[model samples]
Target: MKITQKDVEYIAHLARLEVDESLVDKFADQISRILQYIDKLKDADISGAGLMAGASLQNNVFREDTVKVSPGPDVTLANAPERHEDFYTVPRVVG
Candidate 1:
């Protein structure tokens, strides 16, 4: 888990970043400390904890199926510039 200056340079290279030479040591130290903190989490007890399916409590998320009336062609095609019966007409294009 110890992050070296070389490791920082390698990470920067993988990310295609131009990391300044002066900040390499600083970044290495910061990353090493963060990894050390995360390593300490391995000792945490979780034997009594329940297995979580998800964070949300509610499971039944579906809505009830119901019939609805349509607005019909007249109201639907009212905004069209050119309408034939119940449809909007567009200019045909040839390739």
Candidate 2:
């Protein structure tokens, strides 16, 4: 739980952080405190704790399945630069 200056430097190197000499001591102390809190949590009992399936209470929010009429072929093809019959026409690239 007691994070050393070397540990902080190693962590900074692994994370690709450009830590100044003045901030290394501060970061080491903060990381040590965090590890101490985790060590404290190891003593607590949670044998009966239930696992959470989701983050929210709401579930299965879905709309009814229904078919809707789309725009007519003329309206759909109106935006195309070139069209043949009811489809858009483009240059063929395959040999």
Candidate 3:
């Protein structure tokens, strides 16, 4: 895939990029080289290679679930300025 100045201009217009006129040729050359490298990679042989589900082998890095005792409401609501029985009292928000 050969990249030309017109291709660069069209791509820049689609991406809403303001590519400088001096850098158009440089960008075209770089993009052409990248596409050529990709084409070269497409010709590589991988018929004997095994398919991989993931890059790493690590799995389930989590602690086991366990039942724990809850701190009673008295300890939980100790810092509240106003309390009603077992709940913190807040000012009414709706009229």
Highest lDDT, which number? 3
Q: Each prediction's Cα lDDT score? A: 0.91, 0.90, 0.92
Model 2 scores what on Cα lDDT? Answer: 0.90
Which tens-of-lDDT digit does each residue in 1-95 have in candidate 1?
Answer: 89899999999999999789999999999999999999987898978988888999887799779888989899888899998888888888776
- All models, RMSD in angstroms: 12.3, 12.3, 13.3
* lDDT (10s digit) by residue, model 2, range 3-75: 9999889988999987899999998999899998889878879799997899989878999889889898999
Ranking by lDDT: 3, 1, 2
Clashing pairs in 3: none
Model 3 CA lDDT for position 27: 96
lDDT of 2 at 8: 89
Determine which window of 10 residues in candidate 3 has minimal summed lDDT. 55-64
TM-score (C-alpha) between model 1 and the true structure: 0.45
| Tens digits of per-residue lDDT for model 3, 36-61 | 88888678898899978888888768
